[model samples]
Target: MTAQTTDPAAAARPRLRWLPRYDAPRLLAAQMSLIDQSFGIAMVGCSLAAIILAAGLMLSGDRPGALPWACAMVVACAIAYFGRLRLPGRLTEAGAARYAHGMTATLALIGALWGLVAWLYLDVRMPAVVICILSLIAGMSAAALAVFSACLPVAIAFFLPAIVPVWVVFLATGDVEYLPMFLGTPLYLCVLLVFARNYARVARQSIALRFENVELISQLREQTARAEAAQHAAEDASRAKSVFLASASHDLRQPLHAMGLFLVSLGRTGLDERQRQLLAHIEASSGAAREMLNSLLDFSKLEAGVVTPRARPFRLQPLLRKLENEFAPQAEARGLVYRTRDTTVTLHGDPTLVELVLRNLIANAIRYTQRGGVLVACRQRGARAAIEVWDTGIGIPAAQHRDIFREFHQLGNPERDQRKGLGLGLAIVDGLAHTMQTRVTLVSRPGRGSVFRFHMPQAWDAPEDTPRPLAAHSLDGLRVLVIDDDEAIRGAMSELLSAWRCECRTAESEEEALAALAAFTPGLVLADYRLRGHRTGQQALDAIRQQLGRHVPAIIITGDTAADRLRTAHATGTALLHKPVVPQELQAAIDTLLREAATQGKGAPDRQAAVAK
Candidate 1:
């Protein structure tokens, strides 16, 4: 079998959070180089003194015995000079052999010093003063390198055996005239001083560079950690969306899919008027299911940060009116009271996102309560205003308070709730609250209701205007143009409006709407956002207005919750009522528009008629 090997690049890759440790050989080499340079200068000083002695001996008269000894001293001086060439760079700080070679060369020079001294004492008249001065400078220089090299203390220990003899000779001699025999001793001392200073500078610079490298490495590691954390957060969010879609997919699709079948079934059956009304209720239930799914999809987008806020100065009371009308009928159906206490403060924030948050909270409160009530209230607090939703319901558990805010998490009780939702309501509230830099709080206990509250900044620069309560005009006898491509939806809406005593004219296209407009003008227009044959609600509404010679009040009712729908609706200043439209909400929207028309008297029509259309 052939041997297998790992890829070198793969092997070299850093482990997860690997920490670096000290290496012994590298430390030893650095220390040795510093010491060797110092000792090299020391040896040069001693060699110069030996050459001077040899010259002095040659000048002495009738001194035959001193000649061979003088020759031996000269040879020792030559050996010391050549040894510098053989030695490697800074002994203590170099690699293994380079450090060892420096130590060996230095030891040889020390021995040569001894040999020169021995030969001079035997047969030559050695200048004790000169030799002593030169040797002292050499010895001092060697001592400094030795001390500095103690950082790598092993190198300093190796030099000790060679240093002792030099000290002994200087102590033994006391001749005063011998000092003049060596003139270059001070110059040698200066050379050693220069080398010692240079060694210290090199060591300091190396350590500084190493520290900078480590600092840069630390910053890189920190940035990498931050990037990893962001990636993990994104993955967690994606998984949450997947799980939510998986769990609620069947429930959401079942009602919509069944309603289509039921409508087909109804057409085949020969139903009486009462039976037809019951079939209409089935259709209404299907529409409610579709609305809930659209709401879930909207919340998912907000939680993913795909939607941003479009905030401006607006009175808080109008938003409160919208919520009150939307939920009042549902509350009444359960025999629970719904109330609103509006504040007149001008606020700044994305009204659509804010309204969605409040709507979810209010709806949830109504779902949980058995026989109590829900309240929407607002109050001014310093630079901000607090929007609150209070309810008397099955209160949230203290332990599960936080978990309820997570996506697709519902309280695990067997008692079935009629108002089943995708359970992302609170999660969306949390996300939007974060983006707006607002805080949401919960106050509750078991068997007691919960109060959900958030704060909004006051628009201080808003035009001074007193806030007013919404008009109490019902949708009775108000004329409305209902334009839609779907005949069934159009008929259902017409029946619902007729029950509210509104004059409803149904149209399938712009041509149909224009034909209707020729005979009568409507007070308000409610249109399906998507019509047949590439036509849209706005085009139909516009054509009707042009024929009637007056701008018509309008709002868009749609099953589509795509970003384009939201953008176009807001851009045209039209109210968007997502389908299947809540009857009370639709009636309230028509009432608000008719009242506005009565107040403005149709002068230029605010160009906002394009909103719901």
Candidate 2:
């Protein structure tokens, strides 16, 4: 027992155990930062009040050391307060703890200084001065308890030092006059400590709830980002599918175009009735395949949002007449009447897209009607013209009207007959109408007939120059240049052009075409848009024009349904024809370009002279 040794580590543990423990370290750090920011103005205000109090005490002839002690306390408070303000906004748990402890020490020193003032300056004979100084100290202590209550340990550390010294001094005097102050100081400190403890608990809970809310918001943002990425992936896959369909269609159409030309050439070889009938059947089969491919291509383009409408003013009567002439043969072959009611009503819309809509509707009418005829008519409907297609076909039920416009949706053709088409006519019509910002309506009664109609705004201020019909021209004795990548296409075109009694020169590329131009001066150039070695028809035409030193009218034929290829061809300012080009359509395009070239040739000398100058 006499040789017992003291353990310093064990003794220090109990003293440090009195420090408060925080379960949430990060939350404690956040609370400390908030307290520092919120208390800047309060700190400055308290420092000023302390300086003024010290000056008043000095003027009243108080203890000599009181003024210097008060000034020292104010300086320390300013250092602690301003030092916290200069810290980085974010703090680590250890750093926050250090700051809290430092601030607590500084506040405790100030509180103790105030207590000293009360002890040293209170005059036993001057009751009014005693009351004034004691009251001021009590008020400051209450304010400190309220302000520092966000951190309980700091508030407790400050409160005890601020009030206990005054209480002890009053009791030690053993004077009955200061009995109330000694008793009341303890009660006031008790109430303030309880309130500060309650305030600290509430602050901790509030900070924790705010942290949880921040975490939830971060999770929501992450989920939104993932959803947007998935949507972009889906859109990319859809575009890839469209591209695949277009490429496949182009490859298939090349052979179909050659077959159509070959068939026309073979017809001139003088075949018998049976042979002609077989040839007709083959031609019909090829035509049916081409129609299906075209339908699918149209639907894909509309779905891809590449079909831009170029609206303009044009007379409706001419368009109706053109459709009638085009469809008259098929209707006559089917032993049905194709009627069109023409009017001089001018309408505003994209002529190409509007024609497409009408073409699909008229074709549908001709396909579905077996017993009766189809009627296309236009009527003025107050500021708009209503273009209607009425047919006595296998009428649709009310339930099927909406479904009929869906792709590959067929009514009464469950066998998916090729002759009945792929059921995309109405779908294309609906899509085209929607693109033009117009409405298409249907009125039908089952087993009777159906009427499809759409309204176009009237073009009241349209130009007076109406389009004239194109006159057919004979290609006889005309020199034509044919350029294509495929050998079969070149041979088929040569045979067809020869059948028209025209001199034909064939080339497979720009080099071959330019070489051919030295021997033959062609009036017209017909070239495939996609040629050998990745060269385009436009490039070949440009090279030929440079070699010739003049503009030669040209026509571009392509099987590509890709929107970019179509747009490029359209920009060339030359006639464009899609393949499996109908032999008639190809011949018509060639004739148009040749005739245009010849008309411009009349004034060629004047143009050439201008260029020379």
Candidate 3:
């Protein structure tokens, strides 16, 4: 026998027709929420109305079943309402569909019970009492329509059962008097159904719009979070690049610094013209390399955000004179006349950073200008001084004015000329000026000249008690201790110090330093900031001081460009110098430290004598 085949598609189609279809999952969820929220209010309101209607029927001498049916309806509604409240907070789509179906069935059952009142009492009651009962049923149906309109099918399910039963009873009586009542009942239901359908459409549209808005806001927040993460990553990458540049600069400077010191010593030896000329070339090459490395170091430090300004009152005249003396020979060699107009104005700024700014500006002027002169001048403007560097160089074009201060941005040096510099001089000037809370302004025309100027706030003159310069101190018979991890650096320092008539004691570590100190007492300590065995120059200096029972005059020379190293060295309160140091600078620092020590020593003897007396 052939098996009776059931069409699965046909069966599924009938089930799908009964299931409510929504344009979006959120729309379905929203309708479900509305139903859940309004369920309790509708239940209580309809139940009370049914009780009141049942009481009125009894008072008018209606049937016994009215009171019992009304009570049973109220108890059923209470059970359904409270039971839903006990369910889970978040209802799944299938669960919500089941809820909607169950509520529709409950409402229909209540409507059918109300319809039973019309069947039993219409013939026996007075017309006034019957009309009042019908009115109450109509009112309750209206309320249900309004409450359940979020789902049209549910509204139709409750509405048809409530109104149709009354019409059916009127027709069954087969009397013309009940015809008008029967016709009006279906017509009134038709109007309510139309109203309920329109309301359901509007509600669904509003829910769809609300869901769209929520989705848009969620997308925006995700984009904003992504942007912030990208920004943080860029900042981290920039920091790493700066660190790499600093390390490379330090490594490059070490050998260059050693070469410069050896060259200075070699320059003093007697030599013929050709030898001297070749020596000059070597020195020039070394100097150029040093300048490039220094520029890179400055740019890296600025990028690392470690170049802090320490503003103090200081006379500019002495600083100007020093710059003039240092750069005069270079100007003469280039056959460019260099001039300076020094002012006795006391400016408030970090002296080292300000000096660096001025030096870079002046150097740029001399390097770029072939014929005309360069002038360094200070002009007074109210309570500020405008320190200006004027030069008849290859003036920058108006379009390229801002570009000149960018790293490796040069106007006419497309060949990457070493003599034209590494193109970081102006950049350094800009960075230092910014750190000093000032700005550098430039005025120029192509081929005419450029004037780079920045204002410095004038400070009150230093007190009269500021120490005056001591007489020139000699290095003869001075006791010096040199500590360095690099053997080349240690040997170079020993040779240079010995040449100056200093009794130099060299050591590679604290142990060796202490061993040397047993026989010789140092008048000055010069140490590299980083040493062997993870010890720093500061520690070496402290160790030496403890061994001697006195704070010895010390100088820290370093080739480290790390921000932490720079800060640590600065915090030591010692004269710190960067490597590839010029011979003149080294001698100047040494002489200054020794003179200050001598002055302090002179005061000590007087203090000791006073204490004794």
Best by TM-score: 3
| Candidate 2 similarity to native, TM-score | 0.74
- Candidate 2: misplaced stretches above 4 Å? 1-23, 38-52, 62-68, 71-90, 93-149, 164-220, 272-277, 296-346, 350-352, 361-381, 386-431, 434-453, 459-471, 603-613
User: What TM-score, computed on C-alpha atoms, does each candidate reach?
Assistant: 0.52, 0.74, 0.77
Q: Please, what are the lDDT tens digits per residue for candidate 1 over residues 1-613?
A: 9999988778766662252221255554554444445554544554555455555545653445445654554565456446545655533334445555445554445544444444334222445533453454355346545444323232222233333333344434454543532333344434544554565456646865775888889988998898888889888877765565634642344335334444644545699999888888877777667656765656645634446678877787888898889899999999999999967888888887788789888988898788789999988999988899999998999998899888767774445353667676788788878878887899988798899999999888774464586766777787878887777666766766676688889988877888887786787787877788877787777777677777667887655544444566445666666554445566666666667777877723534432121
Give the runs in model 3 whose Cα sits over 4 Å from its true position.
Answer: 1-21, 75-79, 82-90, 93-146, 164-202, 299-352, 358-427, 440-471, 602-613
| Candidates 1 and 2 compared by lDDT, better number | 2
- Candidate 3 lDDT over 1-613, as tens digits, reads 9889899998799888954444344466578688778888988988888798788878877468878978987987897788776656435654665666676777777777777777767662377776777888788888887788888777777788778888887788787877888798889988888898898999888888887889899888889889999999988876786677678877887787778778877877898999999999999888778778778768767755767787888888888999999887899899988899968788888888889999999889998898888999999999999999999988988998899988778888888878788888888899888888999999998899999999999988682344776666799998989888778877777778877898998988888988898898988887887788899888888888888887777777888777667666666667777888887778877777766666677311111010000
Worst 10 residues of 2 by lDDT: 604-613
For model 3, what is the alpha-carbon lDDT of residue 423? Answer: 88
Candidate 1, residue 236: how far the Cα is off, in Å: 9.0
Residue 417 CA displacement from its true place in model 1, Å: 8.0
**Considering TM-score, which of the candidate structures 1 and 2 is the better prediction for this target?**
2
Every candidate's lDDT: 0.64, 0.80, 0.79
